[model samples]
Target: MSAGDISLVAGTAGAEVVAVAYRSTTHGEVHATVNGGHFALWFPGDELRDGATEGVQLEATFRDGSTATAVLTLT
Candidate 1:
Protein backbone atom coordinates (compact mmCIF):
# COMPACT_ATOMS: atom_id res chain seq x y z
CA MET A 1 0.00 0.00 0.00
CA SER A 2 0.96 3.60 -0.48
CA ALA A 3 0.00 6.90 0.97
CA GLY A 4 -2.77 8.59 -0.96
CA ASP A 5 -4.61 11.85 -1.38
CA ILE A 6 -7.96 12.91 -2.75
CA SER A 7 -9.29 16.33 -3.66
CA LEU A 8 -12.87 17.34 -4.29
CA VAL A 9 -15.13 20.28 -4.76
CA ALA A 10 -17.98 19.79 -2.34
CA GLY A 11 -20.38 22.66 -2.61
CA THR A 12 -22.95 24.15 -4.88
CA ALA A 13 -24.91 27.35 -5.56
CA GLY A 14 -27.12 26.85 -2.53
CA ALA A 15 -25.98 23.73 -0.76
CA GLU A 16 -22.60 23.87 0.92
CA VAL A 17 -20.15 21.50 2.37
CA VAL A 18 -20.96 20.50 5.90
CA ALA A 19 -18.37 17.81 6.46
CA VAL A 20 -15.99 15.43 4.76
CA ALA A 21 -15.09 11.97 5.91
CA TYR A 22 -12.46 9.39 5.10
CA ARG A 23 -13.17 5.91 6.40
CA SER A 24 -11.22 2.74 6.35
CA THR A 25 -11.69 -0.41 8.39
CA THR A 26 -7.96 -0.64 8.71
CA HIS A 27 -6.96 2.99 8.96
CA GLY A 28 -9.90 4.24 11.03
CA GLU A 29 -11.81 7.45 10.27
CA VAL A 30 -10.95 11.08 9.67
CA HIS A 31 -13.35 14.01 9.46
CA ALA A 32 -12.75 17.49 8.15
CA THR A 33 -14.47 20.62 6.87
CA VAL A 34 -14.27 22.81 3.80
CA ASN A 35 -14.88 26.52 3.45
CA GLY A 36 -16.96 26.25 0.28
CA GLY A 37 -14.20 25.44 -2.20
CA HIS A 38 -11.99 22.49 -2.94
CA PHE A 39 -10.78 20.25 -0.14
CA ALA A 40 -8.11 17.63 0.04
CA LEU A 41 -7.48 14.65 2.29
CA TRP A 42 -4.25 12.76 2.66
CA PHE A 43 -3.37 9.51 4.38
CA PRO A 44 0.04 8.32 5.45
CA GLY A 45 1.27 5.60 3.14
CA ASP A 46 3.58 3.93 5.62
CA GLU A 47 0.98 3.61 8.33
CA LEU A 48 -1.76 2.66 5.90
CA ARG A 49 0.32 -0.03 4.29
CA ASP A 50 0.54 -1.86 7.56
CA GLY A 51 -3.04 -3.03 7.19
CA ALA A 52 -4.93 -1.21 4.46
CA THR A 53 -4.98 -3.35 1.39
CA GLU A 54 -8.66 -2.87 0.88
CA GLY A 55 -10.87 -0.14 -0.47
CA VAL A 56 -11.36 3.03 1.50
CA GLN A 57 -14.49 5.10 1.32
CA LEU A 58 -14.72 8.87 1.19
CA GLU A 59 -17.90 10.75 1.91
CA ALA A 60 -18.96 14.34 1.61
CA THR A 61 -22.03 15.67 3.35
CA PHE A 62 -23.74 18.83 2.29
CA ARG A 63 -25.81 21.38 4.17
CA ASP A 64 -28.84 20.28 2.18
CA GLY A 65 -28.64 16.85 3.80
CA SER A 66 -27.21 15.36 0.67
CA THR A 67 -24.20 13.06 0.56
CA ALA A 68 -21.67 11.79 -1.98
CA THR A 69 -19.60 8.65 -1.81
CA ALA A 70 -16.29 7.70 -3.41
CA VAL A 71 -14.14 4.63 -3.12
CA LEU A 72 -10.38 4.34 -3.44
CA THR A 73 -8.31 1.23 -3.62
CA LEU A 74 -4.76 0.64 -2.46
CA THR A 75 -2.65 -2.09 -3.96
Candidate 2:
Protein backbone atom coordinates (compact mmCIF):
# COMPACT_ATOMS: atom_id res chain seq x y z
CA MET A 1 0.00 0.00 0.00
CA SER A 2 1.07 3.54 -0.55
CA ALA A 3 2.08 5.69 2.41
CA GLY A 4 -0.97 7.83 1.86
CA ASP A 5 -3.14 4.89 2.85
CA ILE A 6 -1.98 5.04 6.43
CA SER A 7 -2.92 7.67 8.97
CA LEU A 8 -2.02 8.04 12.63
CA VAL A 9 -3.72 9.70 15.52
CA ALA A 10 -2.22 10.74 18.81
CA GLY A 11 -3.64 9.33 22.00
CA THR A 12 -3.77 12.70 23.64
CA ALA A 13 -5.63 15.50 21.98
CA GLY A 14 -3.77 18.77 21.38
CA ALA A 15 -0.46 16.94 21.54
CA GLU A 16 2.08 17.73 18.89
CA VAL A 17 3.57 14.80 17.07
CA VAL A 18 7.31 14.67 17.30
CA ALA A 19 8.38 11.66 15.31
CA VAL A 20 7.44 8.36 13.76
CA ALA A 21 9.85 5.47 13.64
CA TYR A 22 9.57 2.25 11.69
CA ARG A 23 11.78 -0.79 12.00
CA SER A 24 14.13 1.13 14.25
CA THR A 25 14.62 3.76 11.58
CA THR A 26 13.34 7.24 12.27
CA HIS A 27 11.77 9.06 9.35
CA GLY A 28 12.19 12.80 9.04
CA GLU A 29 9.49 15.07 10.41
CA VAL A 30 8.79 16.20 6.87
CA HIS A 31 7.16 12.86 6.21
CA ALA A 32 4.75 13.30 9.06
CA THR A 33 2.38 16.20 9.36
CA VAL A 34 0.47 16.83 12.55
CA ASN A 35 -3.07 18.13 12.37
CA GLY A 36 -4.84 18.53 15.65
CA GLY A 37 -4.88 15.05 17.22
CA HIS A 38 -4.07 13.22 14.02
CA PHE A 39 -1.20 12.91 11.61
CA ALA A 40 -0.31 11.14 8.38
CA LEU A 41 3.07 9.51 7.71
CA TRP A 42 4.55 8.79 4.34
CA PHE A 43 7.03 5.97 4.10
CA PRO A 44 9.22 5.01 1.22
CA GLY A 45 7.75 2.19 -0.82
CA ASP A 46 10.88 0.07 -0.50
CA GLU A 47 10.77 0.27 3.27
CA LEU A 48 7.59 -1.73 3.36
CA ARG A 49 9.00 -4.90 1.76
CA ASP A 50 6.09 -5.07 -0.66
CA GLY A 51 5.41 -8.79 -0.93
CA ALA A 52 6.65 -9.97 2.41
CA THR A 53 4.52 -10.87 5.35
CA GLU A 54 5.82 -9.02 8.35
CA GLY A 55 4.82 -7.08 11.35
CA VAL A 56 6.38 -3.68 11.51
CA GLN A 57 6.40 -1.57 14.60
CA LEU A 58 5.43 2.06 14.37
CA GLU A 59 6.44 4.26 17.27
CA ALA A 60 4.95 7.71 17.62
CA THR A 61 6.20 10.40 19.94
CA PHE A 62 4.18 13.38 20.97
CA ARG A 63 5.30 16.75 22.30
CA ASP A 64 3.34 16.06 25.47
CA GLY A 65 5.95 13.45 26.47
CA SER A 66 3.66 10.58 25.61
CA THR A 67 4.44 7.82 23.15
CA ALA A 68 2.41 5.17 21.39
CA THR A 69 3.26 2.11 19.37
CA ALA A 70 1.33 -0.01 16.92
CA VAL A 71 2.17 -3.09 14.93
CA LEU A 72 1.04 -3.37 11.34
CA THR A 73 1.19 -6.69 9.62
CA LEU A 74 1.49 -6.58 5.91
CA THR A 75 0.90 -9.43 3.59
Candidate 3:
Protein backbone atom coordinates (compact mmCIF):
# COMPACT_ATOMS: atom_id res chain seq x y z
CA MET A 1 0.00 0.00 0.00
CA SER A 2 1.03 3.59 -0.58
CA ALA A 3 0.20 6.63 1.41
CA GLY A 4 0.13 10.15 0.02
CA ASP A 5 -1.99 13.08 -0.98
CA ILE A 6 -4.04 13.62 -4.12
CA SER A 7 -5.18 16.87 -5.60
CA LEU A 8 -7.72 17.80 -8.27
CA VAL A 9 -9.61 20.73 -9.61
CA ALA A 10 -13.31 20.68 -8.87
CA GLY A 11 -13.94 23.21 -11.61
CA THR A 12 -17.28 24.20 -10.11
CA ALA A 13 -19.21 24.58 -6.94
CA GLY A 14 -21.39 22.16 -4.99
CA ALA A 15 -18.87 19.44 -5.70
CA GLU A 16 -17.83 17.51 -2.70
CA VAL A 17 -15.34 14.71 -3.13
CA VAL A 18 -16.78 11.76 -1.29
CA ALA A 19 -14.42 8.92 -1.97
CA VAL A 20 -11.24 7.84 -3.66
CA ALA A 21 -9.96 4.42 -4.59
CA TYR A 22 -6.81 3.13 -6.17
CA ARG A 23 -6.99 -0.06 -8.11
CA SER A 24 -9.01 -2.45 -5.95
CA THR A 25 -7.98 -0.74 -2.76
CA THR A 26 -10.30 1.79 -1.17
CA HIS A 27 -8.80 4.81 0.54
CA GLY A 28 -10.23 6.32 3.67
CA GLU A 29 -12.51 9.30 3.22
CA VAL A 30 -10.64 12.54 3.60
CA HIS A 31 -12.70 15.67 3.91
CA ALA A 32 -12.54 17.54 0.63
CA THR A 33 -13.43 21.12 -0.02
CA VAL A 34 -13.35 23.30 -3.09
CA ASN A 35 -12.06 26.80 -2.83
CA GLY A 36 -11.45 28.75 -6.00
CA GLY A 37 -12.45 25.70 -8.02
CA HIS A 38 -9.95 23.39 -6.41
CA PHE A 39 -9.69 20.91 -3.56
CA ALA A 40 -7.39 18.21 -2.23
CA LEU A 41 -7.66 14.88 -0.50
CA TRP A 42 -5.29 12.55 1.22
CA PHE A 43 -4.66 8.84 0.83
CA PRO A 44 -2.70 8.75 4.03
CA GLY A 45 -0.15 5.95 4.36
CA ASP A 46 -0.41 2.34 3.21
CA GLU A 47 -3.85 2.42 1.60
CA LEU A 48 -3.28 3.01 -2.09
CA ARG A 49 -0.70 0.94 -3.82
CA ASP A 50 0.01 -2.10 -5.91
CA GLY A 51 3.76 -1.72 -6.26
CA ALA A 52 3.42 0.11 -9.53
CA THR A 53 5.60 3.04 -10.39
CA GLU A 54 3.16 4.32 -12.96
CA GLY A 55 -0.28 3.90 -14.45
CA VAL A 56 -2.05 3.52 -11.15
CA GLN A 57 -5.75 4.21 -11.43
CA LEU A 58 -7.69 6.45 -9.07
CA GLU A 59 -11.44 6.83 -9.09
CA ALA A 60 -13.17 9.62 -7.24
CA THR A 61 -16.82 9.92 -6.40
CA PHE A 62 -18.66 13.13 -5.72
CA ARG A 63 -21.66 13.94 -3.63
CA ASP A 64 -23.62 15.13 -6.62
CA GLY A 65 -23.77 11.71 -8.19
CA SER A 66 -20.75 12.43 -10.28
CA THR A 67 -17.52 10.52 -10.68
CA ALA A 68 -14.03 11.19 -11.93
CA THR A 69 -11.31 8.76 -12.84
CA ALA A 70 -7.61 9.38 -13.11
CA VAL A 71 -4.24 7.66 -13.28
CA LEU A 72 -0.87 8.53 -11.82
CA THR A 73 2.30 7.23 -10.25
CA LEU A 74 2.26 5.95 -6.70
CA THR A 75 5.24 6.55 -4.55
Candidate 4:
Protein backbone atom coordinates (compact mmCIF):
# COMPACT_ATOMS: atom_id res chain seq x y z
CA MET A 1 0.00 0.00 0.00
CA SER A 2 1.14 3.53 -0.69
CA ALA A 3 1.55 5.46 2.53
CA GLY A 4 1.10 9.20 2.35
CA ASP A 5 -0.25 12.20 4.21
CA ILE A 6 -3.75 13.51 3.70
CA SER A 7 -3.71 17.20 4.50
CA LEU A 8 -6.92 19.07 5.20
CA VAL A 9 -7.63 22.67 6.02
CA ALA A 10 -10.62 22.82 8.29
CA GLY A 11 -12.31 26.10 7.39
CA THR A 12 -13.13 26.59 11.03
CA ALA A 13 -9.86 26.75 12.83
CA GLY A 14 -9.46 25.05 16.23
CA ALA A 15 -12.55 22.97 15.63
CA GLU A 16 -10.34 19.95 16.13
CA VAL A 17 -10.71 17.19 13.56
CA VAL A 18 -12.39 14.64 15.72
CA ALA A 19 -12.38 12.11 12.93
CA VAL A 20 -10.98 11.51 9.46
CA ALA A 21 -12.51 8.50 7.81
CA TYR A 22 -13.50 6.88 4.56
CA ARG A 23 -17.07 5.66 4.27
CA SER A 24 -18.97 4.14 1.41
CA THR A 25 -21.66 1.65 0.52
CA THR A 26 -20.92 -1.77 2.03
CA HIS A 27 -17.88 -0.28 3.78
CA GLY A 28 -17.03 1.17 7.20
CA GLU A 29 -14.93 3.94 8.75
CA VAL A 30 -11.11 4.17 8.65
CA HIS A 31 -9.72 6.73 11.08
CA ALA A 32 -7.14 9.53 10.85
CA THR A 33 -6.42 12.80 12.70
CA VAL A 34 -5.01 16.31 12.57
CA ASN A 35 -1.85 17.68 14.09
CA GLY A 36 -1.89 21.46 13.84
CA GLY A 37 -4.07 21.13 10.74
CA HIS A 38 -1.29 19.85 8.51
CA PHE A 39 0.63 16.68 7.79
CA ALA A 40 -2.05 15.00 9.77
CA LEU A 41 -3.09 11.55 8.64
CA TRP A 42 -1.03 9.19 6.58
CA PHE A 43 -3.21 8.12 3.68
CA PRO A 44 -3.38 4.36 3.83
CA GLY A 45 -3.35 3.53 0.12
CA ASP A 46 -6.23 1.12 0.39
CA GLU A 47 -9.57 2.78 -0.23
CA LEU A 48 -10.93 1.25 2.94
CA ARG A 49 -7.77 1.79 4.87
CA ASP A 50 -6.96 4.75 7.14
CA GLY A 51 -7.23 6.84 4.00
CA ALA A 52 -8.83 6.91 0.55
CA THR A 53 -8.26 7.53 -3.15
CA GLU A 54 -10.17 8.89 -6.12
CA GLY A 55 -13.93 8.43 -5.89
CA VAL A 56 -13.78 7.44 -2.25
CA GLN A 57 -15.64 9.66 0.18
CA LEU A 58 -13.93 11.32 3.14
CA GLU A 59 -16.00 12.35 6.13
CA ALA A 60 -14.56 14.60 8.78
CA THR A 61 -16.23 15.10 12.13
CA PHE A 62 -15.28 18.07 14.22
CA ARG A 63 -15.18 18.59 17.97
CA ASP A 64 -18.27 20.79 17.73
CA GLY A 65 -20.18 17.74 16.47
CA SER A 66 -20.48 19.27 13.02
CA THR A 67 -19.10 17.45 9.96
CA ALA A 68 -17.83 17.80 6.41
CA THR A 69 -17.46 15.43 3.45
CA ALA A 70 -15.32 15.22 0.35
CA VAL A 71 -14.23 12.81 -2.35
CA LEU A 72 -10.64 11.58 -2.16
CA THR A 73 -8.38 12.85 -4.91
CA LEU A 74 -5.08 14.59 -5.49
CA THR A 75 -6.31 17.16 -8.01
Instruction: Give candidate 2's error at residue 74 in angstroms.
Output: 4.6
Cα deviation of 60, candidate 4, in Å: 0.6
Worst 10 contiguous positions by lDDT, candidate 2: 5-14
- Report clash pairs, candidate 4: none
Best by lDDT: 1
* Residue-level lDDT tens digits of model 4 in 14-65: 4477666655333345465555653233333333443334344567777888
Give candidate 4 regions above 4 Å deviation: 1-16, 24-27, 39-53
Q: What lDDT score is found at residue 43 in candidate 2?
A: 50
Using lDDT, rank the candidates from best to worst. Answer: 1, 2, 4, 3
Q: Per-residue error at 13 for model 3, in Å?
A: 15
Per-residue CA lDDT of candidate 1, range 3-49, in tens?
Answer: 45433223332237677777744457766556555555555444444
Encode model 3's per-residue lDDT on 1-75: one tens digit a residue: 244554322333333765554443454344445454454445445444443554545566777768887775544
> Is 1 or 2 the stronger prediction by TM-score?
1
lDDT of 2 by residue, 1-75 (tens): 543443232232245667665452445443445567665555543555542466656677778778987776654
The candidate maximizing TM-score is 4
Query: Against the hidden reference, what TM-scores do the models get?
Result: 0.47, 0.42, 0.39, 0.48
Candidate 4 minimal-lDDT segment of 10 residues: 5-14
Those runs of model 1 whose alpha carbons end farther than 4 Å from true positions after fitting are 1-15, 47-56, 72-75
As a whole number from 0 to 100, the lDDT of residue 46 in candidate 2 is 52
C-alpha lDDT of candidate 4 relative to the true structure: 0.50
